[model samples]
Target: MIAISDPIRIEPWNFAPERSNFPTRNLPNRRAEIAREKQLTTLIRENNRSRRTCASKIAEMAKKAGIEVKPLEIEFIAARAGIAIS
Candidate 1:
């Protein structure tokens, strides 16, 4: 009897173009650059809010990880801690 074999398959990944083959992105205009910088500065400036109370242990852990975390509402705290579940 003839042997049964799987048919050949075409994987799109094998034919994908390399990123280096694309042209480099153009730099943003001065106005856009200034806006982006300003937005980033605002985000960093408003990052800390000492409203909710965080656990001492959790705060210490965050500090050791180079992240200054203040306890938010329990919901927010749970969300943040969920990120470290792994």
Candidate 2:
């Protein structure tokens, strides 16, 4: 084994958690940008139910109103509306 003049090139790779190669399953939700979130928050507050129930109800409402919303976004909206959705 003798390699005095090898034409091999190698580069060091830095691992960054924020800039990973894998793509996220869900896209970023417009939590504050959506105007209807306020209304949805109100609805969530009006209903006296658990987190899962509220999420399902809000999803149904959003579906009926032809609005695209996710369960996580609902939690954010509820929090922004000053409602404890824990």
TM per candidate comes to 0.25, 0.43
In Å, residue 16's CA in model 1 sits off its true spot by: 34
For candidate 1, the per-residue lDDT at 78 reads 46
Question: Model 1 — which ten-residue stretch has the worst lDDT?
Answer: 18-27
Residue 79 lDDT in candidate 2: 71
**How high is the lDDT of residue 17 in model 2?**
43
Q: What are the runs in model 2 whose C-alpha is more than 4 Å off?
A: 1-34, 46-52
- Candidate 1 per-residue C-alpha lDDT over 1-86 given as tens digits, one digit per residue, 9 for 90 to 100: 75569677776643544322333432345455556445433333233244332344444555565755553422344453342211
Query: lDDT for model 2, on a 0 to 1 scale?
Result: 0.64
Model 2 lDDT at residue 69: 74
lDDT of each: 0.42, 0.64
Which pairs of residues have clashing backbones in candidate 2?
A: none
Backbone clashes, candidate 1? 0
Candidate whose TM-score is highest: 2
